[model samples]
Target: MDKLRQKDYFLFASAMYSQPISCSSLVEQATSPFVSFHQRLGCFHSDWHQHEWGQLIYAEKGCIHVNSRTKQILIPSGYGVWIPPDTDHEIRSTSSQTNIRSICFPVADNNGSLRQTISVFPMSTLLREMIRYTNRWNQGPVDEAQATTFLQTVQGLLPEEIDKAVIVYLPSTTHAKLLPITTYIQTHLARPINVQWLASEFGLSVRTLSRLFRQQLGTSFSGYCKIARIMRALELIELGCDNVSQVATDVGYESLATFSNNFLAICGHRPLQFIHSKRLY
Candidate 1:
């Protein structure tokens, strides 16, 4: 196993120890056929870790943010993310009242085709109810014949459901100069954030800033802004800001029509459509 980063370790320790009994034991010593953890938490972050079993992380209320080295995925409320076994990643609760439900699947039980990549899938009523039922075995070997069989049925339904995954990953950067700029964009999503303005604020030339974004983040400033706004809109909707027009304005869009078009282009769903879908779960 790879060593945990220093900052990752500190954040993980702080969050895990706050629980009534350390849930760290559940994650680290997951020898059971299946294990699940359901907790209502405020803002939370986990340390870098990998499991021998594939993991399904769901947020019943807010949004779940899953970060890997290469990508950052936002799993909105009523949705879940599937992490393949042996994948290095960390999970975060992006909203204040996040209800996180995590279920682990042994290698033999997970979808073979999806065993190598992470995916975010919308949870159907059947699937969501099935996962919620598993809250029965939060600390578990879950090896009983009936329970194991039920879990296997859920595993079987995954590959088909995961095909409907909505890929909404916000751009991220670790470059020293770009990191602060990215952070600024996230906090100021309601502002008119342009490359020229950012360059002036960060004391870099516009050309230099554009080049840095292209090289490090593989996107233009405007491109990243669009992604950031839409992803933030998703988080807002998950947080109970259900007005489409309000969400559009909050994320820097002056026109509701434009916001709807961009939301559709990016995630193949209109803002209202996404909200309705979320309500179904």
Candidate 2:
């Protein structure tokens, strides 16, 4: 993190750690075939755990970070992650004022492609509206015939919608040498980071460091840095950072046009458009 944002990030991290809530009551109940819960959170962390049922976690206002053993996915505002039953995972809030809506499903409730895997997908306008409508169920014992049928219709639409999954996941690694490097990159995204600088700072030769990133993280050093910058940029935008130029610099970009171009390439929307869309939610 840059010096300018250090205090803000510290507060975010501290608040996130200080406030943790359990979803056991809502997730473990057998009384409902599907249950939905909504809560507004101030950047918090839920340490590693697994649910007895599958969960679709949506962020209506901010961003969520979901981590499994293999990968870490970022669900930006207006997006959601579907985690399968019994899948060990951890969730962390990425922005203050994260409004989370989660719908839990029994093991037998789904049999399509959406079952059995963790997927981060975009929530279309129609799906977002439908999910908002379920606020009436409010952590439901949604066993009523009409309510169940409507929710079923929502569940039925998921498989098709998931085909539009966005690639917002950060590349992760377990290598002893690279783990700290990746973590540092995430925390210091505003710095001018490169393969040569990281190689020297970490006491590894340039060739070896470059090779490690490709072999272990499945991306080149520059590629991983690009992904990290764009992800941080999105999180900042979701947190209500409205100045395009300021956000560009906050993520280590020197050129506004360059930042905007990269943001469009990864997110399928320009930064300003993304900022405008956040207001709709």
CA RMSD of all predictions: 7.3, 2.7
Per-residue alpha-carbon lDDT of candidate 1 for residues 1-281, written as tens digits (9 for 90 to 100): 22223323433555564323333457777655667788887677777777777788777887778888877888888888888888988777645567888888675742576586888877777888888888887554455677778877877888888888775786567789999998899778887887887899899999999999899999888888898999888867765767899889878899899999999987778888888887665
Candidate 2 regions with alpha-carbon error over 4 angstroms? 1-3, 10-17, 107-110, 139-142
lDDT of 2: 0.79
Q: Please tell me which predicted candidate would have the highest TM-score against the true structure.
A: 2
lDDT measured at residue 42 in model 2 versus the true structure, 0 to 100: 65
- Model 2 poorest 10 in a row by lDDT: 2-11
Predictions in order: lDDT:
0.77, 0.79
Clashing pairs in model 2? 1-187, 1-188, 16-43
Error of 2 at 51 (Å): 3.0
